[model samples]
Target: MDWNKAADNAQTLMQAHEALSRLMPRPDAPQQTWLAYYRRSAAVYTRVAEIDRGHFHETMFWATREREKAEAMEQSALA
Candidate 1:
């Protein structure tokens, strides 16, 4: 497996997560709404990280899949 490619993709996912995190609602927004939004976003990042960590001793197929899942989660949150 190409370790460098996996690293690059992992970095990309991390960056996307950071970008999404920065888009959080303002501080004055309803507490429940803000918490719910961030909770879902955090779950995606946590799942992606879990998959990437598992790939340390195996293959790296799930990174992309998790990234797609993250994107879908973000889109669903937006909707």
Candidate 2:
């Protein structure tokens, strides 16, 4: 196996999660900000899915869930 690549993926995943947490919204952020956050989250998970490729569906599932959240947020913003 490609140990170096695996290590790199692990590190990247950690950094991505940390960055996501740092970007977490405060209580009063505007809808546009929330929408952007959700979209960024979806993109993150999508990259994770790509990085984890074929190990299982978990990453893709998370990606799908994130995208759903983004969609819901967008719908709410339009309402």
Candidate 3:
């Protein structure tokens, strides 16, 4: 196996995942759009945490982070 090729593939996958994770509905979307995105992301992480007990903490952390982002959006809207 070519270690360099394997590492390159892994890095590419991570970059792709990161890009997907940061995707929004649009470049100048409303607060509601951002809120929906974050809440949906939290739901996905929460479900994964329940299914993958071995990584519950990590998954829940992501879920919490997503929820926090959503809350921040809501708070910003209220302010």
Model 1 ranges with Cα > 4 A deviation: 1-13, 54-79
lDDT of 1 by residue, 1-79 (tens): 1113233333345553555546556778764555555554454455556555644322233334444555665687689
Error (Å) of candidate 1 at residue 66 is 18
Cα TM-score per model: 0.40, 0.67, 0.66
Please report how far candidate 3 places residue 6 from its true position, in Å.
Answer: 25
Winner of 1 and 3 under TM-score: 3
Q: Where is the poorest 10-residue window by lDDT in model 1?
A: 1-10
In model 3, which range of ten residues has the least summed lDDT?
1-10
How far does residue 63 in candidate 2 sit from its true spot (Å)? 1.6
RMSD of 2: 7.5
**What are the per-residue Cα lDDT tens digits for candidate 3 across 22-50?**
55467677777778778866766676666
Ordering by TM-score: 2, 3, 1
Best by lDDT: 2
What's model 3's overall lDDT?
0.62
Highest TM-score: give the candidate number.
2
